[model samples]
Target chain A: MSEQDWRAIRAEAIESLLVERGLLDPADVDRVIETYNDRVGPMNGARMVARAWCDPDFKARLLADGTAAMAEFDFGGAQTEKLVVVENTPDTHNVVVCTLCSCYPWAVLGLPPRWYKDPAYRSRIVREPRRVLAEFGLVLDDDVRVRVWDSSAEVRYLVLPRRPADADGLDEAALAQRVTRDAMIGVAQP
Target chain B: MDGIHDLGGRAGFGPVEREADEPAFHERWEARVFAMIGAAAAAGAYRNADQFRHAIERIRPDAYLCDGYYGRWLAGLETLLREAGIVQADELRARIAALGGDPTRPGGARPAEAPDRVAYPPAGEGNRRSVAAAPVFAEGDRVRTASFGVSGHTRLPAYARGRRGTVTTWHGAWVFPDSNAHGRGEQPQHLYTVVFDGVDLWGAAAEPGTAVSLDLFEPYLTAWTAEVDT
Candidate 1:
């Protein structure tokens, strides 16, 4: 090749060095990519929300100890150990953003949406949350408090939106299907 | 350091591009780079989360904005590894030259070796741990931020420094990033959720009636004094 992606070559060089040193395995790298790509996503979080919707005691544990509560569903990994579940009632709506960076609970949300990592979102959401919410097509009532939790520290945030009225009789699986990733991140209501 | 990465409230960057059915990685290289960073960290060449993050902050302001999200991660990963002597700059250069000469360069045949940074201790295991320092404030306590001219890695974002806010929640003691970022010991301090009025931070730029808040470590704050607010 006359010219190429320097970053790609640099990455390859780094991997080769690690492989030569016996510190990194190519297979392990493939496994990691597979885990994030196919195995993880909002479904894990939706399951947790569904359990909380149907089981009051489980919801208590989820709000109190997110990591342990998630253990009920066997969902815990990188960036998810210290999760703070923010419940959204009719009076309060919460949205999460990592102003410093896109510090999402990757294990639950899978990779973050590009919008979550956008520079504009990082700056605006905390200052003009209502305006930003409206842009996302969510218009909160004036009385409802819009709380934007900035991930300035290690703690991750997950939104437990209020269970919908018609969803009251649905079983956990059906309720889980109703919970969207945007609702879990507090940008939309299920 | 007031790097471009601390992007709260600064302007001119455009709209949030919400993709329709986005994939985990946009390029094959991105996926490889992501895996490489994680694997190398697990293999013992690393920085703790705070120190690792500071590496991203330490990036030149222009490059921080110019680089892709994971591209910045690759940059930070390389910077930390190079600084720690896990990877040699010259060897990387020569290997890049070789690969640039041939895009299909076979894997694991590189002439360079990443030195063992693991023998010392791993960095980037930044997590919650118990510490002996007594917390300086608590929830509901009015506090004033201390203003300092730090030209190094700092968790106290420039926007909120020297501003007064009420402590809304005590997140318990966590690693003080200001100290930890410099390879200094974890002088753990109480981290709190400090709620500040929008005007306090943004003034004319703030949306009226909106308030912004963030989690701040204890070292970055002090007890509120009536004289300071006015």
Candidate 2:
């Protein structure tokens, strides 16, 4: 059967199960899941990055220790692990991927979107970071050393991409407006 | 037994075929289990004895998957208890009352906080030092990664340990606790960086200028000068 057919079958099965179990109201679950997928995923991490850019001290703390650094902004909720923010400077560019699994800093960053944790992305990115970033439309010059961090341990890392050149004078909230989750992962720059 | 964070480069398992939709079943199941455990303990149905024994039994299964499973299980348990009306605010209050101020253990009235070593401090604050942060060596200082073989959970990746590197950075002290949570108690040790030249790590074929810096716990390191440079 086609991929579309399989997806449809799976959706129907899940809907039937939920309805029968009374664990969820079908319409409400659909809405809740949609909202969570769209709003509560990468956007959260983007906001944290913007906040860090606007505040130097906050950025310093984030670089030093990610979990505590994130709590400063009160960004994470229950699922968020302690944040470990890795920074990307001119000399060194940091990229994050879970080689072993799709482990991410979900508390501050929200959820790991589908693409970030894909097997294709995880497997290829670690061994060939420069090439992978290029595919994501990020091309770093030879001078910049790419450091790929594997969040395979207790410490989850966030990439503090250098503040965008055009973002000068932007306030915390305004800067946050421009930061995308992709930027923090070094796959895309704001 | 294996710790939750121990899956690294293990071979042989083909990707388990899973449905594209319906929120990964494994993820949901694990979350539910964690939540149930937390709720059960909170309701006084299980004491520290039960909680630890269960944790020990459940801890070693697929390490990569267990962390999220346990985390979600705790969440599910909390949600289930609240919904079932087995616990209310007053009951929560009473449980604490019964424990009489020491809420550190399971069923002690207070919910168990994430253990100390695993708990990071609030942002903008210095990381809590556990005696593992201080470095006995400095940059250009020669040292050897511990030759000790891996047993249970170890942070020393197989490829990196035992290879010599320089003390490039002194990550602040941290409590090793020997285990993920200091629940096993504190085995405070200093963390340090031993920078191994690419040539050292990959051998003669390594790129000329490449170097790998590793953050190592103190126990995993030892002082070695040219005297023992074999």
Output the number of the TM-score-best candidate.
1
Residue A135 deviation, candidate 2, in Å? 4.3
Each candidate: RMSD to true structure?
Answer: 4.6, 11.1
Q: Is the docking of candidate 1 incorrect, acceptable, medium or high quality?
A: medium
Specify the CAPRI tier of model 2. Answer: incorrect
For B113-150, candidate 1 gives per-residue lDDT tens digits of: 22222233432354676767767787789988878737
lDDT of 1 at A146: 71
Q: Show the colliding residue pairs in model 1.
A: B1-B152, B47-B123, B47-B124, B48-B123, B48-B124, B48-B125, B49-B124
Give the per-residue lDDT of model 2 (tens digit) for B70-166.
Answer: 3323333333333335444354444444534322322211233332222332223222344523467666677888766543334565545567877
Which residue segments of model 2 deviate by more than 4 Å? A1-41, A55-69, A76-84, A97-103, A113-127, A151-154, A166-174, B1-142, B177-184, B193-200, B203-214, B224-227
Per-residue CA lDDT of model 1 for A29-91, tens digit only, reads 667668877889888899999999998999999998887887777887888757888899878
**For residue B215, what is the lDDT in candidate 1?**
82
